[model samples]
Target: MIHPRGIKSLFLLMLLFPGFASAQKDWQDFMKQFPDHLDISLLIQDETGEPLFQQHAGKRIPSASIIKIPILISLMEKVDEEHMHLDSLYTLQASDKVGGAGELQHLPEGSRITFRYLAEEMIRISDNTATNILIRTIEMDYIQHWLREYGYEDTQLNRIMMDFKAIEEGRQNYTSPQEINDILIKLWNGAWLNENSRAEIMHWLKGCADNSTIPSQLPAGTVVAHKTGTLDYVRGDAGIILGDKPLILSVFVEKFDSMEEAESAIGQIALKAFRDFGR
Candidate 1:
């Protein structure tokens, strides 16, 4: 007679493999649903290192502000190293002020904000001013080393937060869907950050000020830890969709005719992913 533990193990394996198979098939079907003209790249992978869907997962794209992931990671590492404190104050300067999507810019110069508060603004509201301040305080080489150590060669922050010179030189910033997905997965697993740091990051991401992409199509109660990046006609969202089985996803669309069109396309893709594999 087979052992009781063996029987249980067999049953568990049977239950898990079917869901994996179904997720893969659903992703394949969804890829064929979209038109060929759209310049898009996407990746959906479950927590078990299984890819549910993939399309141009390796292609490089202008990350816009999505490059902030590295900046955020660098900050956390600093906290871990005892070089900084979450509650430590960072005084905003004129150089830190940059034009972008956020409320920090509206605040007058010399506004004092805690590092934790700045991190919240950076992720929650995609605040460029807060991002710049953090970047300025945290060394770029440190951020670059963090990315390389994490095996994210394709994700690079070539310039400080919203540096116009870099933007003008065609080196604004860049990352891949695969890279973003990897970052989100690491963050979700608390591997890239200490326990407290991971919790704080997720809390901020959950309240992301912009959710027009991934969260826009999911159910009301679906928990998504995500970040959205936008500039003119470009739009991108990357995050982990937490449900019964969490799936890491990154969808980037650029060169669209208009922001509205880009958002609609992203919504369609997200809806399909949710309906097909989010079960």
Candidate 2:
């Protein structure tokens, strides 16, 4: 049985994208497999940036490492403008260490690293230490201003990753599925950073080691350039799924009963979209 909210969502999607009515029905029906308690926000667009499906995509929630997307973009913009060089080095400090999904914290202090290395680790491993370093190097205030200037009012990187005190103070980073999809679409269309900058970012994203979300259940050899975000109660994956019909997909699952279940549901939803779009 479709949840009442799902029914309303289906109606709106059909009304918004009439050509996708049949596909929407199939996908929405599959959505019933997820329990009503889970908060799932999703946005799927074709290469042209047309929304094929969405649900609560504009509802902002804790972003986890997904906030890195904007940070990465901010850094790349500086590089494109010749304001920063990827080859430039920044030395690590004891204060820069944080406990989370990265190896940088294990490295000794005083280890000098390049901006390119920091950027790569930030995306490829969701490195909290690298992220904090880049956040400091790029200036958090500028990133906040850039987000507002671009009208991403719902997305903000207010605190460094894995900062427990900040979390206790409620200074968490937040973003919505729609916001992420919009960013990825621009990146896909060459509307954001220069070609080289975008390519470098994509290279890092494609190598991301976390395959437990969107890419978990995909057929082998699928080319997916994406980022995954995880916290105690939030799980998200946003990326460009390349194929005959290239797609931009962002799925964020929050407030779930089980981590395993949440990740499984995300993969199932993405796989369903892959099939729907491939046809």
Q: Count the backbone clashes (under 3 Å) in each candidate.
A: 0, 0
Write one digit per residue (lDDT tens) for candidate 1, span 1-279.
122433354356447788755655666676666555567788777765455566777788888878887688789888988999999987777767788678888888888889999998899888888887887788777788888887787898888666778888877678898778878877777775789888877788888878788888778888888888887756888887887778788888876777776777777777777776667
The residue-by-residue lDDT of candidate 2 on 161-261, one tens digit each, is 87889989989899888788888888888888888988998898899888898888888888889999998889899998876698899999887988898
Q: By TM-score, who's the top model here?
A: 2
Model 2: residues with Cα > 4 Å off, grouped in runs: 1-19
Every candidate's lDDT? 0.77, 0.86
**Per-model C-alpha RMSD:** 6.5, 3.7
Q: How far does residue 111 in candidate 2 sit from its true spot (Å)?
A: 0.9
Which parts of model 1 are misplaced by more than 4 Å?
1-29, 32-35
TM-score of each: 0.87, 0.92
- Clashing residue pairs found in predicted model 2: none
